[model samples]
Target: MDGDYVIGGVFSFHYYMHTVKHNYTTMPEPLSCAGSINSRGLRFSRAMVFAIEQINNSTKLLPGIKLGYEIYDSCASVSVAVNVAFQLSGGLDPVFNTGDKCSQSGMVLAVVGASGSTRSISMSRIIGPFNIPQRVADVIRRSTAKVVVAFISTGDMKILLEELSRKPSPPRQWIGSESWVTDRDMLRFSFLAGAIGFGIEKSVIPGLRDFLLDLSPSKVADSPLLTMFWEEAFNCRLVKSEATDRSVCDGTEDIKTLRAHTLTHLISTSNH
Candidate 1:
């Protein structure tokens, strides 16, 4: 009559079948990595928590059954992630609860922020120890979830695309907004095409300027690109505004002067 189940052990055929029938998919559940507060991973975690709550409240799943979750703050650190894994395996305190059940059925980890190739490799190495069971390890190693999105202007897009090309299994999709770049950036377009060759199924570029045009200046400026991209991608232009000249080149002379001064200072320091 015991409802508790201890995983990571050999199971009888009957028990295996019973658990299989009730369990979610066998994939290693996604986990989020973020700071303790004010992080994108935290927001994602909140949404997941809300969904589970709704499901349990409405009895959407098995009548009396409910979903359980455990959160670990990676602090965006691989060391923290490894430590978290150990803590979870040891039945440490959970961030959220599901009635009387204590441990989570599985883990969902998230990786946020960006890193270069070297940093990515280091992170992969840090998490390598936990990548046991060759099958699961292989999936994690080959997963595209670790890839990053770069939006630092079209010039930087070429470098990012080149890096992606070097990956064994490149991203399967590219999502961005029209404001991400100018049409003249052929390298960016070509990179999208190349990603498709490496299993990239689709590329999505959102149209956000049209939507922002109608919103108040403050609101438009405050919106995150990710949120704006989601909203304006589907031809939803809820804002209207008059066009005005707003170009970075307007202060080109000042920038040039600053650069010249910086170089002069550097040269003088070196001479001394």
Candidate 2:
């Protein structure tokens, strides 16, 4: 960012919801998504970076546009997405909190993100600024020409459909992605119509399976991203000071003890 560049923002759910605990002593320790990391979602996030890098290199795409981006992890949570949006817009500084949500740096031309419907909606409200964020808790309405699209799980779709029903907004067209694009239960909802989505396109990624199987403690130790993933995978904290979970990592555990998502963990280092 030393020279002229077009900055964009990327938001994706790199973590999957695992569990919520109400057993905390206080107002429930918000350990957000169990601090879990989804290997598949990690890959999706990498894809966005790759695409942006490609556009910056391409002479035909945006001939004069030297595109760069700031990526944010939404944790697949609506509330978290709002914080991200506020950060992106600089309207609410995410860093400084003095009982007043404000920040000195919030700037972005556009945002290419939000994997889920709920997240996408949350982002649009903050970005579009029809002052829609005030009603996110109880109501969500839109007054725009473009239709709202969604790419969420079946359960999330149910919540989104219910929210849309409460408002007077017209039935907006949605373009679906691979997830829940053709869900049988989704077809039952009248809110989503003409929701065309690409079905599963199978392709054998050569050498990918082998690369994943080859990962070991020795290999992961060199990578900070992998090391963090390992700790999250095992539900342990490698750093003694940052240890929030009861279980502590001795740093001798094998990487195989964590679930292997070759596609997911591979791209994490690229960002780091």
RMSD of each: 20.4, 9.8
- How does model 2 score by TM-score? 0.48
Global Cα lDDT for candidate 1: 0.34
Residues 1-272 of candidate 1 have per-residue lDDT tens digits of 01122222110101001111325557643343321122233233433444455556675564666445554344433334444445445554443222343434443333322222222333445454343333232453367574433333222344344555555344344443332333234443443522211212333223221222233324433434223322232223324334423222221122122344332321221121
For candidate 2, the clash count comes to 4
Model 1 misplaced regions, further than 4 Å: 1-36, 93-272
TM-score of each: 0.28, 0.48
Candidate 2 lDDT by residue in tens digits, 1-272? 21134344434444444445456566743323434455545555546555666677789998876665555666676666766777667633433222221123337677776766677787888643232344341333545544656656544665566666665355557777666675565666675546777777555544434444465656666555456666666666655664364466665675454444533355333332
lDDT of each: 0.34, 0.55
Q: Look at candidate 2 and tell me the lDDT of residue 52.
A: 67
In candidate 2, which residue pairs clash? 39-264, 90-106, 93-102, 93-103
